[model samples]
Target: MNGKPAVFLDRDGVINEDRGYVHRWEDFSFLPGAIDALRQLQQKGYLLVVITNQSAVARGLCTEADVLALHERMCAFLRERGIELAGIYHCPHHPQGSVSDYAIACACRKPEPGMILRAAQAHGIDLSRSLLVGDKISDLEAGRAAGIPSLYLVVPPGQDEDLSSLPGVQRVSGLSEVVERMFGSQAMPSS
Candidate 1:
């Protein structure tokens, strides 16, 4: 397959309000302007992919099936709105997790680049031209390691993380800001 550019997104905070360890459809809420931003990005010819680390499974807070169910619902919700995701890759491992099966330090977790690299290969994505948008430094590191040149950090309100010192990473208030900056007002498509 020919290589195409993609926008790698972090699921929790970037697409939905990260109500810590969200594993149920009832608890999921799309962030404001997220749907429109996704629609615009897709209209611009970028494959949309989600690369996330779901430690809740390892922590025993939720089962892997629970996470998968949530993701299925999320994809359906987006598809109903005309935004189709190229892929959704999630890592369910943590070094200190309580679930032995998913507790080992895995390569697919954020800061490891395993998921992004795998996604690029599986989807024929051109890492050199792709972009990643996430709310954590680990997300940026993963994208960078996967050779994605553009990285965006979504700084939610009241977020205390100091990411200003990080070189080569741009900070935005939310998905809307990222969309506005990338496409410009003139190129923005109506939702």
Candidate 2:
């Protein structure tokens, strides 16, 4: 394991409420205490990397530039909270997408580990020491494939999904809880 650890995050559901193809800043909303959790992770020297699947681009719901704009807004919001992300990786392909060229089985999609592997290679991140926090089982599976030891599943309020059947994956109410588990009592209070 590398001395420095990284926190790989899922954009939708985990970082923000899964609002269904969030392609605009107006549609983006950060989950409760998410900024704080990210900042806490940053304070602990963990490189914050966002690995997300943006199939909306391929489905014709939005364009790549639209996704980038939303991400820019997200990064700006994080910056206001004093959190700097190391990198943001997104996969814009979907097997049954509407776009003419993007409709194909792509390795970069979630559950494939392509995005995570690419991020690891680009950032020189040690997967064994990294933690991946996501809201779906596919995220955990990708993390597993990428060799990320700590996998956190975030279940939002009123969400009926249960992932207890998955072994070696920890469940959390939100990113805040994951931060607590990672930093223990030493975790700083969110501003």
Best by lDDT: 1
Tens digits of per-residue lDDT, candidate 2, 1-191, equal 45467899999989898889988999888899888898888888899999999999899999999999889888888888788998899999998999978888988888989988888888888888889999999999899888888999997667666666668788889998998888799999877
Candidate 2 residue 138 C-alpha distance from true site, Å: 0.6
Tell me the TM-score of each prediction against the true structure: 0.95, 0.94
**On residues 1-191, what C-alpha lDDT tens digit does candidate 1 reach at each position?**
36999999999999999999999999999999999999998988899999999999999999999999999999999999999999999999999999999999889999999999898899899999889999999999898888889999998777666766568788898888888889786557664
lDDT of each: 0.91, 0.88
Candidate 1 regions off by >4 Å? 158-160
Give me the candidate number with maximum TM-score: 1
lDDT of 2 at 137: 94
